[model samples]
Target: MAVAIVRNVRPWGGAAADVVIDGTRIREVRPASPAAAGTDGESVDGRGLLALPGFVNAHAHVDKSWWGRPWVPYGGEPTTQGRIAHERAERGPLGLPSVDGATAVLREFLRHGTTATRTHVDVDLGVGLRGIEVVREAVDRLDGAVDVEIVAFPQDGVMRRPGVLDLLDAAAAAGAASIGGLDPAGIDRDPVAQLDGLFAIAERRGVGLDIHLHDRGELGAFQFELIIDRTLRAGLQGRVTISHGFALGELPEPRRLELLDRFAEAGISWATVAPPATAPLPWREMAARGIGIGLGTDGIRDLWSPFGDGDMLGIALGFARLHGARTDGDLTAAVALASAQASPFVHRDLHDLAAGAPADLVLLDAENVPDALVRGPRRALVIAGGRVVARDGDVLL
Candidate 1:
């Protein structure tokens, strides 16, 4: 029964209040009380800070991020296939002796106010379950500091590599929270079979689906339909997620509206790394339609591109800047894309800094929500599970 009090903080950049925590759950949220000063629990002074629900990163690749390694110029890849080839050629040989790289990035994520993330660990014929094993090990090591949802990601198309399903099954059995897939039409060349295989595994294993659907335009819409049909049939609805469904945003206005209706109906969600594109994602429309859309860093300084620093605040700002969000309302919504808006998609019981909720939160040196969004201030304190895990940009846990 460890008790703690976060005093004088503006929750969601609102009016100042004191959040009282009893062990792992928030006990109370009320105006500053003079009596709280004499309470026996630990007290974290939050003056001049804006408190927010800890950000949730819905899509990530933690196992093989080339984040801490020496810089390697991205090998030129004219097409998606070329990029796949370059990635396999470059990443296959990066031996894994320790979980140092992944741990380092997870620490950085905590320092930047992200307390939980869903990381896709590669599961393919080449690497088998080695990547998943190392990532799980890291998760175990950092259990209390950051919560991680492991996705057994078939980065090298499931059907393209024989016996990959068996490896994925093994990884899931070993404790992967979900199963993942690459581009069905573009990489596997068989959207129906690939989706069937992915959904079949998810159903059989009693897990969830987080497919990487990067196919563009009409082809992407075709794949999305197939996914929706399968999700509806299997009754997986809210349990299914489509990462990087960028093509849906590229469709004509009428078509996009129709499909968005279908997405809301099926309860399917979308996760984006907030990549800059010629045609922007219809995030505002999606939000209006009650669709669940979350943000992620995708690959943190990985072979894909030389970007990402595990800073969700910086990425939230990117989401705002990319979408031309200048008004206060727009900026607040952008920040929520990485926080409350994203958390429920991953786990319905998570997010929000309310009583009875887990005390997973961040206190930033900002006056309000809009200020936090525009400036991307450093975290003054990051509390996960009612414990101060990181303070002043240093990971105490």
Candidate 2:
């Protein structure tokens, strides 16, 4: 391990300090006023900049980065809209090639100081997770530049896809971080059975679980209960997650509290994507009650939303715009969902330039943390495993 100190750096917009990077760890962080005596490797004058922990996009779908060419319909929306448009595309014979779609989007994420990202790639009908193969290749190509984890996501109904569970296993074999599935309702209106099978696949294969439940109206807690229950019973409790369970829409106050209490017990992490746009503030209330809310990009550049810029700055802005975190503390919790407090889920020591933590951090141009999200990912610097992978608005890979 070697030492490289950054002087005059403000982490989390606090006072100036020297951040020591020793090997792949943030060795020690201290106030810089006294002019610390020890020096070895190199000293970078981190003047007028904020040092931040790398933004870990707990969720994303990089394959759809260029779905909108201003011509085709959209992606990952309500099936009706897509089906209707599919006919139109079939008739008009228009399509967006997946290979060329995701190029610039990856660069955009790096420029915005996103060092690590976990993306869900679809393995549904007609779509064979081919894009995942491309993503894996791209991630390898961009290996040192950015950290990208691929999840074999069954964007559509899992059971509906022939051999979907098997394919999920294959995705795991291909190094997907977890196995993913969509609403149980769409696959046969039987959320439990399909979810049970999916979780079984996870336990048997020893993989993590990331499920999407946009069908809140129909599935509701019935689906979530299954994920929670299976995760607990299999002793894989904290290894699972539930995404977009928005159907908890304005959950009755009593039920909301009770459900959150149970959710905390189950140790299931919540994924917040498209928060401002989706709504139902009981979510914030739930988080306050000890529920873990991990942030994700959901989809980057899809047809339905057309807005994901692959930069988590947009995710935070979208959240703050809708949620209104009045105080710095409130904003702290909101941003914490993006990283820290994941605890037993992911990135054990994900935030802060804390010692003994993975050296994933950002150098921001913004005045403060919350201000960074609002002001846009500014003058970003990304460091991963103690290596300066990205800077000066360039994608090394």
Best by TM-score: 1
Evaluated against the true structure, the overall lDDT of model 2 is 0.67
Worst ten-residue run, lDDT, model 1?
A: 32-41
> Can you write out model 2's per-residue Cα lDDT over 41-74, one digit (the tens) per residue?
4666676588877776777777765543554445
Which residue pairs in candidate 1 have backbone atoms (N, alpha carbon, C) closer than 3 angstroms, thus clashing? none
Please state the error at residue 140 of candidate 2 in Å: 1.5
What lDDT is reached at residue 67 by model 2?
A: 48
Off by more than 4 A, model 1: 1-3, 35-41, 76-78, 96-98
lDDT value, candidate 1, whole model: 0.82
Error of 1 at 165 (Å): 1.6
Q: Estimate each model's TM-score.
A: 0.95, 0.86
lDDT of 1 by residue, 119-231 (tens): 98888877788887777677778775688888999887889898988888887777788999889999999988889988888888888899998889999999989999999
